[model samples]
Target: MSSSLRVSPFSHAEEIDFIQLVKITLQRKKLVAAITVSAGLIAVACAFLITPTYEVSSVLRPAAINELDALNRSEVYKLPPGEALTKVGASLESYETRLGFFRANPGFFKEFEAPGRTLEQSFEEFNRNSISLILPDPRKADSLSAYIKLEMTYPKGVDGVSILNGLVNYAIDTEREQIASDMRVIIKNRLTEIAGKLDAARANYEVDKEAKIASLSELDNLRRAQLQDERKALRAQLKTLRTDRVAQLDEAIGIAKSLGIRKPSTPSLLGDSERSPSNSVMRTEINNQQIPLYFMGVEALEAERNALMKRKSDDFTEGRIAQIAKELQLLEANREIEVLKSREKEDLFLAGVQPLRAEEARLRNLSIDMAGVKLVTIDRPAQEPLTPFKPKRLLVVVIGIILGFIVGCALAFIWAFIRNRQSFYRTLPISSSGAGATSLDGEPPRIS
Candidate 1:
């Protein structure tokens, strides 16, 4: 026979092989159909087993205009004192101080740390003892801490998300109000300090007034007494001089009278150009009147001298007293002015300070605001399911069917390769039986 298209020594009849292939399909039809049906049914089951989730959302706005203005005035403008409400720095500083203490002295951790025998134990203890939050807790899941990891997933298409967002917004607003509260305290403190200083200044002025007035009064009294004494002394001296002058004049008049030879002629009351006394008695009486005139002249001179002393003393006292009065008036005026200034600063201007009063005011305001927050609610979110979301059997089966088909094809190729190996002998360097040597087909030649 020709080399081309000739039958091989091991060749099988083509029709018979065709018949055998048909027989195989007919026999395995049930198995293939069963596998395909199982795969399809499993996929349908998997599709039905999935879980659905919902989402929520919300929005936030910045602080109100009036609130921002109040804060700006207190923190930036440095305006005079006013009644703008604000927050205190007490809590902020306290928080910082706590953080500092923890950072610098980690030993403080010893007392506060979770009690446990090992690091892992301690971590668990801390989670159980110290940690509290609104999210999924790890300790709640037994195997999650060891083998599985979890995360927080934000869901979509839900109302409760809005509630959470609103809560966050509210927390931010609270912080803003707290800032203002601190500003209020700072300003209030400044106002208080200024007020105290003003009060002290006023007190000093009052004390000064009392001392100055007391001294001035004593000095005035002393001056007045001295003037009186000087006037009395001058008057006494004048009176004594007048008496002596009168006596001396009387003696001279007597001597004159004793020497009289005849009575002096006297003018009558109607015509007083000349007068004479006809008897010794009338002449002596007229001469004695001249002694009274001499006494009058002496008394008048002494009175004039006393008046000058009194005038001089009064002039000195008035000048000194006036100076003291001027100084006192100036101090009083200054005190009044300072009081007015203090009032204006406290009543009209704003000082950014943190005060207890500011905190109280802020709390009251928050009370009003929190009432509004309560109205906002989370209506929709990822909810629990009527069906579980695990074990996707249908998809798993379809994948298994495809994998089985691929494996079947590989088995068919492997069978063909084995048959080819047996036919081809010397081309491939393989032995039927040897240590560390093997035939291409996974069969040992019978130990012939």
Candidate 2:
């Protein structure tokens, strides 16, 4: 018994025949051509109808060293050209900065305003899509290759070039203002610190001066007390000496009257026994010693006693009394303490204050006009582009034609498949065993 191989028609359906596909496409040439032409015409119309978007780009480089020299020379705050460039770039990329710029110049972005969109929505769209910052890739860039590129896109009728240039300038100005404000704060803080130090120094100086004055006053008081004591003692001594001289002269007068002697008498004149050589030697020896007051005559003793009694002020008798009075007078004033108290400019005497004052003055007098300061160098300014950046007419039409051709080919194949399956069903015969339908020639139907 020979077994017949049964083949299913749908088995070949998964396989593609290019010739058959071509025939099917040719048969539907009108439909394909219609679709292709319609898509190309639509694309052309869209290309013309869509708004043209223009791109404006600008490059930012580090400022020249000379441009930043003034800032660095401030000594209070310093910023390098590269850092300034970085700051400006950061400002350009900042959303707040962009929004600020947008709000500041509403007329520039007036085209972005629409009926349904709020200003915030407009800005969001602008910030997300319209602005782009291109920085050098860190992995491929060197230190000296640092730069930033700013690109802006806008539709026709918008001044993209002016907007780009204005944005760059605004970012630079914002960064410059920030730098200047930071420097001013630093200077103000330093000035405040200097003022505090000066106040402290003055306080300390005042304390020291007061201490010195107190010490000098104490010392002068002690000196004055000593001088007063010495003066009192000298005056007492003079008074006692005068009283003793008066007593001695009175005693001498009594002795002279009792001895019946009227003149200053020596031992030899007193008696004949004292006239010997040995007595004369004794007299000479007695003269060498302090002589007795009775040896003076009554008249001379009385006159001396009278002068002693008449003496009122004995200051001339001792030179030390005059010196003590002079010293006491000097100590009463304390010239050194007086000088310290009368000083008008105490800052000059404080240590380390001259340099601080000079610095404070310099900082106070510091005036930096950031208006002329350049934060970044514009390598290339934004120029008006002659051509639009988007909606390329030829490319769009070409793509549309290609897509339409593909779609037309797909539809042609689908219609061909439907027609072939319907014809196969119409020609199919019923099987005797009631299993399935088969072709009239006892062969499986094939898909055309």
Best by TM-score: 2
Model 1 segments more than 4 A misplaced: 1-67, 70-160, 250-254, 257-448
Tens-place lDDT digits, model 2, residues 173-289: 888888888988898899999999999999998898899999988998988998999999999998998888888889889998898767777666577444553543344433566
| Model 2 residue 293 lDDT score | 78
Error of 1 at 193 (Å): 2.1
Looking at model 2, residue 105 earns an lDDT score of 95
* Ten-residue stretch with the least lDDT total in model 2: 277-286
Worst 10 residues of 1 by lDDT: 80-89
Over 1-448, each residue of candidate 1 has an lDDT whose tens digit, in order, gives 2121322323442433656544544555565556556655655656555443322222222223443344343342332112111111121123333243334444423433454455445334433433222322456765331111111122222233333333333433454455446555665675576556556655665566566656666665666566556555655665566556545645544543454312232223213323543334322224433332222333343444445434423323244445544554544334444444455334222233235346535434432232222211122323333332234445566676775554444445455445554654323343234432334444333221
Local distance difference test values of all predictions, in order? 0.40, 0.85
> How high is each candidate's TM-score?
0.39, 0.82
As a whole number from 0 to 100, the lDDT of residue 440 in candidate 2 is 54
Give the Cα-based TM-score of candidate 2 against the true structure: 0.82
lDDT for position 24 in model 1: 49
